[model samples]
Target: MSDVDSELMAGLARMLAAGQQRRAARAQTALETLRSYERRILREAAVMGYVLGYQSGNLDGRTGIGGPLDKNNRIPPDSEILRRVIEHCDSTDDLYPFLAAACDRRRRSITKARRWPGEAGAR
Candidate 1:
């Protein structure tokens, strides 16, 4: 090919490669954002579970029963399984699994509630 054509082709190749890199970077950023959102949601859900559990226990005539917590940074919950789940984690990596456990209970509670809308202990 002519020198001009060769250079043009090379320039196009560079542009294509750069575009691909940009797309990959954008995808990575999107994935990271989604992951962050999921983690935050899980942590928040777990915290809600903890608060609800505490309230429920109080209402049900149980007094002074809850797991330890990290006050500075908000984390997820307490209970039969939730008590240990609340006391389980300290860091982000550790917290996710604990949060998941709490969320699992939340999930079960949801399913049970849906199945038996007017009953207690539906599951």
Candidate 2:
């Protein structure tokens, strides 16, 4: 091949490598963001469980049941709640709103359940 052809091939290879690197970096960033959201979701679910009087126990890897204990014997979040929340979230943008709405609904339900039957404005 002529000098011009060789140079063109070399430039094309560099461009391809650069594009691949950019894509890889973007993928890594997305993975990290998802992991962050996962942690947040678990924490929120745990809080919800605590509010609802779920007791902590030994770590058992079960969902919708008592969670296994950590080193301090504290149970993690309820896996079932986490699974449900994640099911409704299609992206990071949806996570915050979904989590907030879920928590609010839980709060309302708890409040409604606590009222006496004849209490004013009680459902």
For lDDT, the strongest prediction is 2
Model 1, CA-based lDDT? 0.47
- Ten contiguous residues minimizing lDDT sum, candidate 1: 74-83
lDDT of 1 by residue, 30-109 (tens): 23433466545645665677677766766776554342333443333222233333334312323343333333333212
Report clash pairs, candidate 1: 77-86, 79-83
Q: By TM-score, who's the top model here?
A: 2
Question: What TM-score does each of the candidates earn?
Answer: 0.30, 0.31
Q: Which ten residues in a row are the worst by lDDT in model 2?
A: 101-110
What does candidate 2 score on TM? 0.31
lDDT per residue (tens digit) for residues 1-123 in model 2: 999999999999999999666544443343344446555766576568654554433233343434433335354445444544443332342334433333333211335554434553754
- Residue pairs clashing in model 2 are 58-68, 58-69, 59-68, 59-69, 60-68
Compared with the true structure, all predictions reach lDDT values of: 0.47, 0.48
What's the residue-level lDDT of 40 in candidate 2? 70
